[model samples]
Target: MECCREPSCRKRGRWRWRWRRQSGSGVNAEEEHGIKKIILIGTPNVGKSMLFHRLTGIYATISNYPGTTVEVFRGRGSFENQLFEVIDTPGMYSLLPLTEEERVTRALLLAEHPEVLIHVIDARNLEKMLSLTLQLLEAELPVILVVNMMDEAETLGIDIDLAQLEKDLGIPVVATAASKGWGIELLRKRIAEYVRKHGVRKGVG
Candidate 1:
């Protein structure tokens, strides 16, 4: 009965030790402080709320359509033996800002200065959604663009080249169907790595 300050080596009833670092590589000083905060931002019905709930197990009044949640919700989650505060912001279309709720979302990003910004997006509408992704990149924020709702995209016969997208975007791009819990573990691991590292280098995914 031994315990360590890391993930349990018990996947699929087998013991497998996994060491997590601040970056994809090994070793970094940023791991000392742990993950202070992570903010989830996206447009309406992009699964930001769902992914937030899934990550933190905190309910934030989910609905079938948009304009349901007019406020932000914050919760806590633990990954890679590190604790993090997760914030769910109101839907926003772009960083340029327009609606009151959208402005509110932008305000949270500026105010909180989260360690990592998880941009959840609907994969079916990549062209439209990528606009905001571009904006986030322009701001020079540590952003991880999540191409969520992949299942819906598949149903519509919409195929996305994730590797190409990642290369083009110059950031980590994760394809997931948050509703079905696909690619979540990888997302978590990526987030943990970003937090542990000072920040991902520019001009590279």
Candidate 2:
């Protein structure tokens, strides 16, 4: 498993997200780091920060739709023997900029050029939340949908066919109960695999 530590491979997975550093490729270390960013974007109260904490193992400040992530939070997650910088952007409902926070989050997305954009959504609210997902896909960005709060959905008898959703969206979909630590390992695996599949060995600088 080139992506993970040998010992952790059993639990982590075989493939990993890798950012190549070649001296003559004109790609400096800082820009290479930029290529390693994993961003989380979605509407408010969808367990975005919970998923972020599970991925990064860091405590993030949570609120009830504060709507201003002007001061974003980031932490590192380790999988496949490599570390990924994960970010929690402010809540945004559409690609069209409306509020200041949405504009901030939108600008950051274009500026950073992240390796993977994980869109966290409440599994029970898939219909309303999916429009933003479609918009992200229309932008031709690499996006993975995280169907979070499955435990709650299950309690409410809400069933989501993840495989079908993935096939229909033409992107990766991972169901997670971030608060309960479900599907996190698989989430990590998918993140690594997505980066490896999409990223070409070239300069991001």
Candidate 3:
């Protein structure tokens, strides 16, 4: 069996010591300890939520964006002994906000400054989604493109060259069928590897 290296699996006394130091005002525990943040952003009906559930499981904290009615989901996920705080933002077609949800999502992106910005796109609608991916890259955010719903795309005889896409985008790209849990493990491995190399963002306090 693989040995567990999670924070909770550490020595009790050491864990308590670390927890005490991480406890503070304003920031949450994850932020206090410098846990990396992963934000999922994409247009509606792109399997974004399903992908989020696949990464973080069913237990999630649903809360409205501060000072707005737009809801956001936050959950915890562990990959390769690294703990991450994953956030599922509202569907946004573009960085230029039109709807209130889009505005909130954009605001969250700026305020949170996540370490890894995951752009989940529908494999069947690759052309339509590439625009937003370009926008994200232009903004200089660390992004990972998730070509989700590959099964559907395959059904329609749509083929996506993930290797070529990754090469062109200059970032990690993954293919997944979120509903069927395909490529979820590879996604986790990629996330952990990305974080391990790039490290967490500074000034998160």
RMSD to the true structure for each prediction, in A, is 11.8, 10.2, 7.8
lDDT of 2 at 157: 98
Off by over 4 Å in 1: 1-35, 59-70, 199-205
Overlapping backbone residue pairs in candidate 3 total 0
User: Judged by lDDT relative to the true structure, which candidate is superior, 1 or 2?
Assistant: 2
Steric clashes per prediction: 1, 3, 0
- Backbone clash pairs for candidate 2 read 3-80, 4-80, 4-81
Please give, for residues 1-205, the per-residue lDDT of candidate 2 as tens digits.
1222433221122112222212333544444343477889999889988888888775333322223536777666767765576778888999898988788778767755677899999998999999999999999877999999999999999989899999999999999999999999999999988887887322222
**Candidate 3 Cα outliers beyond 4 Å, as residue runs:** 1-32
lDDT of 3 by residue, 1-205 (tens): 1213444332133223423332342345444355678999999999889988999988676777667888988777889988787889899999999999999889878867688999999998999989999999999988999999999999999988889999988999999999999999999999999999988775422
C-alpha lDDT (0 to 100) for residue 204 of candidate 1: 8
Model 2 scores a TM of: 0.77
Q: Flag regions of model 2 displaced more than 4 Å.
A: 1-35, 59-69, 200-205
Ranking by TM-score: 3, 2, 1
* C-alpha positional error of residue 53 in candidate 1 after TM-score superposition, expressed in Å: 0.8
Tell me the TM-score of each prediction against the true structure: 0.74, 0.77, 0.84
